[model samples]
Target: MTGTIHNRETFLSQIASSLGRSRLSSGVTDPEWKHRPQDQVLQDATPDELVDILKTQCLKIHTSLVITDAKKLPETLHEVVANYGGGPIVTWKDERFSKWGLEPLMKKEWPSQKLEVYEWDHTKGAENIRQAEKANVGITISEMTLAESGTVVLFSDKDKGRTVSFLPATYIALVPKSTIVPRITQAARKLRELHHSGKQVASCVNFITGPSNSADIELNLVVGVHGPVKATYIVIDDL
Candidate 1:
């Protein structure tokens, strides 16, 4: 234990000495020394520009992006489901979805036998993933989106579990265009502020960029090993 402590102290001392030497050699002080971050361009980007960048990045990351007006979202979503051969769908229970008139549309469009819509239940715990895994598709509303990395951030809980994005064969995400930021820093800051404010933030905050892919075994490409093989991002402009 003593030796480990001494080694750790030596490592820290070496780091401090190197930093001091570098600072002394560079005669100028960086603005970061005062703890101020660089100017955030993403936060200043217009919503429309951010959305455009997000769409482009999504394609590069192998994630499909569907843009539809708020009024046409239901039909658009239905089309996507039909293309996937409408089956079981696991979705996060967001109150906004019902208000957007999706619930009625779903009930009318999807018959009980033809389509099963499962709302993630908090009481199920780890079993939530099991339910989602059985579904053909999973859907969730993204709280924030990073255009830089083509990532959609989901805050999950009993009402909305990360399983909706991680377990299904196809993951569909509703990303409000307004939520699209230029990068991840702003998304992280928003999350931190929410947590600092004592809001009921989710235990699992997920950043999903695209469909799961790995070139692991003998360099053979594999998809959907860890998560959904297909990820669809629906950018709802009106929202």
Candidate 2:
């Protein structure tokens, strides 16, 4: 981000000089932006209200939202898997899945299980991408969520690869209620604190609002052009 600012300064300086305007210098710091009505609404929302607002915003962008108990996550995941039918499942290595007791649903089941799922190996580099490309579902746990825009924030790591949230037909985000901030600013503040505290922040932090869609071709809306055809956000009430 700092590098981006430096590049922007150079580019803007050239444009400003051409227009005979004052250059946006590197020393210039923009004033902090005030909150908009949408932002303020989220900032003052209760937990339930935040979820409702997030769900509404998510639906507007063609993302499905589901609320479920932490303990019932296995059942919810089963339904998601059933909806997608049996296929290769690629998931990020989040400890929350284990804490939520979704092992039975994620891993190979016993002899009498209803459905069998192929768990993609959590590897690195091209191998992981190769596995995820053929996967039907990409499951990940959000580090935090933005209620104002219904965005799920994912950080890439050794356990959670970047492609784990992309390159799949279906993307499912498992977010805990506690991790859902009232707005994006709050989320950014938390991450900034973590960074300043000397905690190891991941190299990539992806803020996903919805499935990849575009209407640039001919004005007709298109879905899943560069991302999942279906995106689902499963919010856990208790985590």
Candidate 3:
């Protein structure tokens, strides 16, 4: 959904007036920086190199990474679900699942395997959250994958509920190789491009890196404090 800041101009004007200055909407120039080290990091890396970087980062974040081609995606996904304890699964109502050849797994194979599955329905509203809470695993297709940070980016909308990734005990992200970027810098650039092109940006954009863990309680690492206990990313090599 498109969001607007109410009374934004008035609010800024009030602040400017209090400071005895007029709002400077023009004649402002961006400052030059001495160094742009961010641009240099992994600047010339190839797709294969990026994948290697992502795999390394995944290990540090305690996230499992599985790389497979399009032909083996179904089998890889099935193996991941089964390894995570054969879920009462919840997934986003994303068309990519079908486009990527998961229609059979979601519709026929999973049911025949006696796995319970639920898709996020916008019409159901809060019922979706309840289902997500009950699920052992929640699955989603990542809109963008950050190789440097091993982050899976999700754009939440009518079909993609925020709870699909937040509430489930285990979280699984289907990462398309084509969507992998160098880092958040590239991700932010893409978002800016979308906005400049007048596309509707998602209200909630999640940058999830592995499972939730906090060291708040006596400085000991505690997992699953606010979200999933385990996380995995199955990267499709030929999606």
Lowest summed lDDT across 10 adjacent residues in model 3 is found at 104-113
When 1 and 2 are scored with TM-score, the better candidate is: 2
Per-residue CA lDDT of candidate 3, range 11-105, in tens?
99999999999998888787999998888889999999999999999998889999998888888999999999987999999887888788865
How close to the true structure is residue 74 of candidate 3, measured as C-alpha lDDT? 84
After superposing candidate 3, which stretches have Cα over 4 Å from the reference? 1-10, 25-28, 32-34
lDDT of each: 0.80, 0.80, 0.90
Q: Using TM-score, rank the candidates from best to worst.
A: 3, 2, 1
Looking at model 3, residue 114 earns an lDDT score of 78
Residue 206 error for model 2, in Å?
0.3
Candidate 2 vs candidate 3: the TM-score winner is 3
lDDT of 1 at 183: 82
Rank by lDDT (best first): 3, 2, 1
Candidate with best lDDT:
3
lDDT of 1 at 119: 80
What is the alpha-carbon lDDT of model 1 when measured against the actual structure?
Answer: 0.80
